[model samples]
Target: MERIRRLLQRKTLYEPLEGGSESPDGEPIPHSKQQPFSWLDYSVFLLLGVAMLWAWNMFLAAGPYFQRRFESDDRLLRNFQSAELSVSTVGNLGSMILLTKLQARASYPKRIVASLVLNIVVFTLLAVSTRLFLGVTASVYFAFLMLVVFSASLATGLCQNGVFAFVSGFGREEYTQGIMTGQGVAGVLPCIAQIVSVLSVPEKKSEQGAPLESSTSAFAYFLTASVVSTVTLAAFAFLLSRHSPRQRIKRSLDSEDSENDPERFVRKSVPLVRLLKKLFWLAGAVFLTFAVTMMFPVFTQQIQSVRDPHSAPRLFQPASFIPFAFLLWNIGDLIGRVSPAIPGLTLTSKPRLLFILSISRVIFIPMYLLCNLRGKGATISSDVFYLLVVQLLFGLSNGYIGSNCMMGFVEWVDEDEREAAGGFMSLCLVAGLTVGSFLSFFAAGSS
Candidate 1:
């Protein structure tokens, strides 16, 4: 009973050690001071987030290329390609949930290193699978492809949880912001790579009589992804090395056993159920935000052209709109993620207002559905300018609102709870991605 009382007392008196403080043992406790924000911190967090999600974005960005690989008439293949993220998101969701429940001694840096190695292996295998199965039956090809995607998704889930958890340990919200910004870059970079790949391919006739297979470009992209994974692996190792004082402090703090720390006792005293309840609103807001935004990529690829393919500018041609829309969305998302840094613009202090704004995004669904994409005649969907505007809005809102919710959730929790909170937020975000991906099937059906 005395132990319980002490724990409760600690909980009640708990405050982050931003400055020096005395522990119950009458010893001075050093504050876990965060290093002043520097370009190195920004680069690490941003690149880490980007590296974690880059493969997933490549899967989505390569949809047009995948469509061209299969029989031209196979709408099912197109749908599957479009929904690949949802499929992997299932794996992602599962991994995060398991991480939340499991207690292991593995540190975030180790987890990240393992996840990066796994990603490199998975991406390399994915490239090989595409090449090896190119001549095989479609059934065999897609089966192998899906397996690879699931593996990548599972790796992504682990990496994302680790990255977020790792960054939260810094006790700075900007680290989280940098991760979100990196994710935006993840989405944009693949599209840019795809564009460059498409533009670089020499116009040549293939023996199969269709233009040269897009698989060539895809192979190069995956290979590039693998190389990037290696670079990230190196960067993380360097960052976590003892030479860096900031990381040394974090490693020491993170390595401390929970039983040895009074702060851990206070964190443990809070009921898990209460913490979850506190996080429910932010999670739901993220779910709805992503659920609506995901449908954009699903329908964008199928839209009928507003003008003749030959008449359009090279960049805005019918063949390019899908990637173009994706690129625009990502660029807007990057902008939105950064926008919160501006004074007077952050919604972190206003959860209810943020919730309302998130919910209001549903209006975009009906508006997008009404567009004349894939319709018999030119309509609002065919208007490149209009579609770009809507996509920009969609991406912007998703980034701004999602970043605010995540940052706020972390800030609301005790430092010890921040890692779990990040994992919980990831759970919600992946759930949203999964739900949205499933809904895209219905959207595809309607189209």
Candidate 2:
């Protein structure tokens, strides 16, 4: 009915929404003056999205740094990413399960705020730890690092569930996509930073025993992440205090949803068990989607350019190749995430197709294996172009398939069940990350 009134009002007052008409739920139609959300709202949520995922994405971008820190222990160096992600996913999964079971629409804002503070404190610790731990053994510092990873995962669980529930309850497709857009930004920035950190290592020193990313650079990078969280937290505090139009309206509507039809909402929600059952397919689809995605980086990080490192330019050397490839993959991801906002590009009413595509991403495993892995010989040699193109398409498909799965859940269940569905889906997504993180050990090992 709300969607209908918006359409009727649009036809009478304005010419028509671009893209002929709104495509479907989760579709990003062009905005006009009449829409409730403004540029300010979009900016806030975009930062929210970035701050929500920044910690882990920072870890992802700083894989080489972690590798360097653990270089003394070959086994630890090989498996630090897997272990860090393992702890993170476990922490995320546990917290999300608890948060989902303890549902209250009013708590969403609180969760986001709390999560932001947690992220800031944890990131600061991470930044400072890089330069400190002077006398500590590498293993002990690695333990501290994993603790940070675990704490960040807890924050991720809270923020992801809160942000999605807020967007879904607010019933705005564009704002959710704004978060998606910020996710693209989140993915890109860390990759760029990784490239910079790797490059900043002086050529002379890099050729020496210290081939790792600079500790100073890593310190600056992690500290910058902490500052980002501080800014996002301040922005959110302002949003709540200012009581913008969007917040005002959302509060009233949320109240109605909670207070007006308490019995109906309870009846609609049933139990968490039953609610999750209804979303088995949705959960499974997201599970498989991210399961495949999480496997990519661990293996791909080992891939080297086929160009002869001795003669090839610095940019093409093994050290630089890793970060540059990550940058390209993330750049492709940004493009793919934004593609759904465009009219013709969005995938709608295509769950089966999306699931099939999700499963099909497994093919990338062999594709990566075929590339010239550093220690492992390559079946596909002298073909850096092949690896680059594969990374691009890999990222594009991951973004497209994952976005459509998230958006189409509204169509998957009853109206009152939408909120519960959001939490369950968030849980499922993190569960996928956990499974994939563990599986990466075997995947990368095989490579």
Candidate 3:
């Protein structure tokens, strides 16, 4: 037990520093005198972070299903994704700004709890709407679906901002890394659920051509998401409770932060733009990273498997190929997100290297485009192995560069500044997402 505790307590990679902190005013910042972080605390944070993005992932995983719903209407089905992303991104950005304006109370637990409850509601509505709207016009159904997307988007912004702010308040890079890692896992979960939902539910004949997927599988998918949210909600609620040992330790740190730097608790001009350099190009790096990643679920979903009928596995079939691809990318992303826990992997505080790396990720566009995309005979390679390699590298770079930028920025700032940095970082991230959502329109058109 002692050996395990010692191993888990190892120091995380941070900026090049001499184990000291300095405030903006040049005063030394003291380290926390709180209890040691236990394994349970790490698990709770990771799980809660996973829950934070669960709804969005599930929605993306259900994209093909949504297209199926619009099968009869060629126009709507063709452009449903573009419109859906627009609505969700608009809602996400607007809500994040609103929440930032109202975040003076630092009601982290309440914000997270409310968002989780909202997510459960949104997923439930998605599950029900598929069957309930079978008789309605496709346009009406798409409108209703967009509303659900907006709700989930709103919840996502709230939960993510809350989690980021809460973790940043403590100024612990390990916690931040853990939460980001959990988010990568969040991406992975829906892929598994998607496959399960598709395989478990029986398909029936459509009035038109081929068979259609049943809402039963979708119900199970959303239900699984609801259960995850429920479990994470309970866990977060307990962390806020006074009885939990972990909560007590964290609360002490929070109290100390408040007492030591009362100015941070009060709102002031954040100088968000001024922080561009101090943040070590994290804002721009994150912005570009996600903007490029806009290819995912949009352009990515278009990459059909090139199967060798003579020796292909069932997973390479049309029914399961997309989800399997999603799984591989997310698994690679999870690996990259967790890798920074090791020292020097991200080269903290090195802006030039990070910036170059971020810019270089644009090469993935050609890599993906050159694949047997759209089955349009523009192929550099038709090998499924080649496509898998591209996805793994794509996801790995996304997580590694993004995580390092944020982690490096967090480490470079003082504890007092971290709370502000947190909000700023999240803003940049969402800004990236919003731009990516718009860019995906052009990407889809070109493809």
Candidate 4:
């Protein structure tokens, strides 16, 4: 009905108001003004596209590559460091979430840019510094890989929250759907990245028929992914600069909004207490869901430990099991994203049940642990199969939980609080990711 009214209003306005439309008063005329596309509207779409692609690229080459490098290869030192990396990466979620909350009360494009740039630079430098200090070599590169995983996890968590907060705007439905869709699509990048990894040129042999060395690892595929990601990031930065609070410098360049009144600079900031009260329930669910989700990483570590003396060596292998598991998980999530029908407009018949079902993952994780720990050899393959089934179901549970919980939270908050809620959501998600990583690595690595 609202959309229909807007359409009708647009049509009526374009029709020239029937030569003297007035509302029962001695007025000359009333004209309908179509709202102009604001910076907020344009930036949301721009960021949505870029963020999805950016996240996709981040995970595409990185997930499988890192899984194999840090978790697959059984280097004692690397294994130990990977566990450390998990804790640091997870712990960083606390800082990342808090910063987002702090930044929520204001919108300054330069500050946003500065924050993002600093976060990325610090993250990258930490990894590079660790690599150089440890003297990275294949023999001990697992140590560097551990640091890289840690840095990437932390950076990705921060970047995700930051990007969404700056980019998502007023209203619940469009914004929440946009996030879910982008994340869903982005989450699939590894499925394709796996295929791309297979296409890299193998090293050619010399006249002596001894093969020359090649620099690319299966994970070096991420270098290409990173380059692609850089392009998306630059585009996002450009769009954001044009449409975000960061547009101050651009305004100086173009001299637009020079006459800006003080009123244009202010937006109401919500209270922290108010925002937390709305999120309290969903926050618990998110925390529990993510904590349980850690079992997959643990399962991945165990699977990579599998060896067969008689099987042929294969290049460009994927964490096929994990991705497949998520594919199933995402399907369930899709179902949750769209709920079932209701009768007679009973408010009680709403889709809140989806959120409840999603919480079942907490129960499922223990079963996964029991299956994996039961054996190896003939038992390992069967254990892996059971783990995959559990993950597929887990994905379904995630879909239901994620679909409604976020939307419900947004509905409960005010317009101002919605922005703060976005930051809180990110914090909770990262905290979960961090915790999951820490527990998984410890369990998987502990013999």
Q: Give all candidates' CA lDDT scores.
A: 0.69, 0.71, 0.71, 0.46
Native-referenced Cα lDDT, model 2 = 0.71
**TM per prediction:** 0.83, 0.84, 0.83, 0.63
- Report model 2's TM-score to 2 decimal places: 0.84
Kindly report which residue stretches of model 4 are placed more than 4 angstroms away from their true locations once superposed.
1-81, 84-88, 108-154, 195-214, 217-220, 237-269, 303-355, 369-388, 441-447
Better of 1 and 2 by lDDT: 2
* Candidate that beats the other on lDDT, 1 or 3, i.e. the better one: 3
Q: Rank the candidates by lDDT, best first.
A: 2, 3, 1, 4
Clash list (residue pairs), candidate 2: none
- For residues 1-447, could you state the per-residue lDDT of candidate 3 as single tens digits? 998877665433322221122222322223343535556767778997798777778777766667678888988877787787888888988888777666444555566777899988888777777567678888888888888888888888888777776666445567777888998999998888777666665544445433355666567667777888899988876654422444345445667675786443344435555566677477788888888887776656777666653466656654567777888889888888898888868565686687788889888887778765765544655655545668888899888887787666766665445655776777678888899888877787888
> With candidate 3 superimposed using the best TM-score fit, by how many Å does residue 338's alpha carbon deviate from the native?
1.1
Q: Determine which window of 10 residues in candidate 2 has minimal summed lDDT.
A: 18-27
Residue-level error in angstroms, candidate 1, position 358:
1.0
TM-score of decoy 1: 0.83
Residue-by-residue lDDT tens digits, candidate 1, 1-447:
999999977654233333121222322223344345656767877888888889888776565556556554465554566546666878888887787654233245556777889989988986786677567666566677688888888788878777776666566667678888888888888878766665666544334333343676678778878888899888776665522454345446666553476553232333447667887777778878888777887677765456665776655554455677778888889888888877678888677778788899877766666565764554464465445667788889999998888777865677556666776777778888888888888887887
